[model samples]
Target: MLESFSNININLKFTIENEKNNSISFLDITIKSQNNCFQAGIYRKPTSTDNIVPHDSCHPQVHKTAAIRYFANRTVTYPLDVISKEKEQKWSEGLIQTTNTIGNLLKPKHNNKNDPYKQSGVYQLICPKCDMIYTGQTGRTLNERLKEHFNDFKHIYRKSKYSTQLLGNKHPIGQINEIMDVVYVGNKGSHLNTMEKFYIYKETTKGNQINDKNTVPTNKLFDVVILQ
Candidate 1:
């Protein structure tokens, strides 16, 4: 069986043992990959396709609540808290995790208009008219960085020495206000600088990006996928 599989560039995994009747039995086979693993069960005997069939009674019967509770108990890294529904009598093992450790049930939720950029990540700002793009990343939240961009526009208006080249007369005026769209690329925290450099390199190669060119160092590696 191993030789047969090898002929087709397929690897077969199993163990064979001699039986009392001068026969061989194949044990279970295991296969592994980067993110997952699989195991094949042993067959009692070699049989033709016509004689082989799946047993209907061989299915596992796992209770949903019991399974949830079992995993919840094992995976409770932080303090575990359960919230029963209002006026509820049934014991619900299904959990709703919260950052709050204080037993406050009525904590008011804040609904900010710009809540999407509350995460630390790499992002892109695109111009509507010329399709020019600016690739950036933030150690803090994206909203904070975006606010800085808006402040740069204000500096441009006041003719500050620190005026942004992103909105100069050479480029599109009021380009910040005419932003076509914003994109959230990835959440690489400390590695934001490297990731941002990677994106800037890629965008500049396309000849439509507004970012000033700089020599990217080849010393670091990042798991970046640029789909053009």
Candidate 2:
């Protein structure tokens, strides 16, 4: 099956394996064979960590709420049966999870949002009028970095490549939501830098990114995650 799928697309590679114990996992979800039918639910691998980002981690609100949004969206969007619906509802309601040793629910802790580590990450900013996009990374809050771009555009400053070009082209000024998308979040490190470059390469191949080609070279590894 792997060879067959690999041959279907010369540029792509495929891997196949058999499901075991009537259950199999795929992309954060698990599928189970039940009475000649299939049921799906959230899945977490044994190595998964229950730890979460610190409240004052400086991660954007989007990043903080991503998991909740995903769970809520899945609960509402997936065509789950009655029993699955109950299970999902209970899980989504926070009825479960968050216990220490005695199975008693523990209160979550919070930190002062002012003093914090910079939540570095890769992000994309788009030109509303021309649909052009820029891929970049920063060791700061995404909002902070994006605000600089907006300011540069407002003042016609040469501080940023993307903002200067957007203004020079006489493009319409847009709100942050109109142009920015947070792609990945991490600390200031090589991983964050690599992800930024990878996204730039991805957009460049699509002929949309305004940023220059990144130092990260082309690799076949991305094919595993990318859709054919």
Candidate 3:
């Protein structure tokens, strides 16, 4: 208590208000300014009955009504970007909740209006020309996984194996514009190989071209890697 008081450079005093029933208690503080001869009074509730003014015989008006009116009329503002982000955060949280509640069958919800990629999950890319599909999984984000495909689409010699095999065939649909649509298959996982294999099997059974032959890679690291 002494340490807290010593940290402050201003002259101040504190008083505690005991709670009644389930209502919460609060502190009433009084401060004296050294810089100017300005006096201020602030409280959550009036500490004394004299602070309240009796106008009507039945009820009384508030004593510090002018201070309340002044603060009420004060202009308040927030950044437009901050407001946009707050709204986006709420939308994302709702999507996360809805995704978790539903099993594998729920269609992929777009993270944004223009983007089909999600923050995390197993996703499938469908061919525009044929009914062929490529299923893949990522522990990171679907955006990161889709980026690898986009990289393959851009390069002549593709770095992503699945991207090359899926897009490099005779009935090739190499461009992102040519691709039909992207859909989330299973939930994101650390070891997504099993889920990817299951979706691949399902799609292959439905007559879709299977690009990946190897389900489990040799000496594969299964841990979810987070990059700082």
Candidate 4:
């Protein structure tokens, strides 16, 4: 025999299983209607079945569907509150004037408006060991420019292999203890390439008998350029 609620309307069935003691045992179960289909537990003798019966109600199985629905509802409601709070905090902090200045400094200026290269000063370096002349340019103050080079000169050293190899492996600009002479070729808004070439040639060939412009020893290596 089997039992179920009147509204549920489960159908009943029975089967017989032969026991080891020669006595026949009856198995009864219910079938439920599911989407115009039927489903039921398998009919077998309780003694012959080795499978463990589940508890009357498991917490996870009972609550899983409702838990998922609750979390889904919370996800929809909570993200808006989080975003609103974030916006409020950002508004309260406001924008700093120093932040604006820093932003302007980091922004890239297009050469279409004005030539950035022309508005920067040029630098020249002579490797005492190789007699190789290098040219460079910068918009930052001299001390700041030199500090930047010292901080990140490995990248430049890697690129200018010929210059580093010829200079007896000396550190670029700042690492060397000895002071090297530096001359300002020209102010901002000028042909930096021409100015650098002219001054480099002039200084290198001043007392020497090298009359040929092409024969002057120039490394043509640039380490860094810091734009304002």
Candidate 5:
């Protein structure tokens, strides 16, 4: 049973229209027949608090307006009559105007990301005898990853480029503490890829990068940071 299903967020609801109900509410719209024509209008559950990502919050602008975009999209896409459409528009305008109100404070995300030993982010492994360095990211702890690199280099396995490239150049590979350093801490995913690339780019600019060049398109955001 555990393998077959889980009920974490699977909600069950009865949407069947009863004798007293003329409209069916589905998702964000209400649908019903008027005269001889079928019509649909925006719907909001009574429990809706009209809350969204506030403008004053420490988050990306796009993240703040994502809900607003959805509201505008629904207002344009739904078959609401002029009156209902105007009401939704006014509601959306009010919501946007009130977004400047700050709510509970949240600690800056950097507070957590700065912990080097907590794992998951870009790291650098340097050759003991050369200026070259290998930058990489992993979801696991840096200690574990660095140990893996050391073992791979000692065994002459081809799994890691850091191992093969360093030893191939007749360089000595030391234990994790002697050669590895945590560069930036971040969670796993494509975000790590960008963070890893940023460090690699830095190393390459200094003529010390040992990794192959990446083909990911140039990120304008990275350029803005580097130019400063």
Candidate 6:
């Protein structure tokens, strides 16, 4: 003869409130039967309350309340059935272990090699209000670009009268604003030249008009040329 047999069914539903001032609530219903007798249980977690409590009940039950504030707004449901106490305990332990393993696996891992500033295919903005002119190159280091600019200035000054006259006796034509050096990795050819020209024009214009905030002077005597 069979000693005992049990059947259990569990249903869970929950609501979440993301607002700081609001709350969320949920209801859980459980039904169990052994031999000929049946038992029903109801659980409720109210928004104002910090603990969940089980209530005795029979037949179908309905539980309702405000939402919880401290927990993430999510709901999970599972069914439970058992024929013996040992089986029930084993099933519960297995569920807990599975949930913990999944949670750990989903967590983000950190690595030192990741560079947040390294970007490709885009233009970077430099500060036009700064004291120095920042010259930069794509696909290369800012220091490298600065070195190339100085080399070019030196070579051209000896070969061309225009470069000698413009550069004059200045040892370094412009100081490198290290803080404002931007690498535009995506811009190509004419677009890159235009961007460089724009930066130069803006910085020169702002420097010349540092004292005036009103309309630009009508006289063409301005130090910087405005390229339309």
- Cα lDDT tens digits, model 5, 34-138, are 788767778889987688887756899999989999999989887898888999999998988763321111111233534565576678888888857888888
| Local distance difference test, each candidate | 0.45, 0.68, 0.47, 0.40, 0.72, 0.36
Clashes of each: 0, 0, 0, 1, 0, 5
Say which prediction, candidate 3 or candidate 6, comes out ahead on TM-score: 3
For model 5, name the residue pairs that clash.
Answer: none
Q: Where does candidate 1 stray beyond 4 Å? A: 1-115, 157-163, 170-190, 215-228
Q: What is the C-alpha lDDT profile of model 1 across 5-59, one tens digit per residue?
A: 5577546445444443332334422122223532222232344121211122234
TM-score of each: 0.38, 0.46, 0.37, 0.27, 0.49, 0.24
How far residue 31's Cα lies from its native spot in candidate 4, in Å, is 99
Measured over all alpha carbons after superposition, the RMSD of each candidate to the real structure, in angstroms, is 18.6, 17.4, 18.8, 29.1, 12.4, 21.5
Clashes of 5: 0
Q: Rank by TM-score, descending?
A: 5, 2, 1, 3, 4, 6
- List, residue by residue over 89-167, the lDDT tens digit for candidate 6: 4443443334232122222222335331342222222323333333333544444544554566677644322123335
- Better candidate number, 3 or 5, judged by TM-score: 5
As for lDDT, the candidate ahead, 1 or 5, is 5
Ordered from best to worst lDDT, the candidate numbers read: 5, 2, 3, 1, 4, 6
Q: Single out the weakest 10-residue window by summed lDDT for candidate 3.
A: 219-228
Span of 10 residues, lowest total lDDT, candidate 6: 64-73
**What C-alpha root-mean-square deviation, in Å, does candidate 3 show against the real structure?**
18.8
lDDT preference between candidates 3 and 4, better one: 3
Residue-level lDDT of model 4, residues 171-204, one tens digit each, is: 3443332322334433454554444544445544
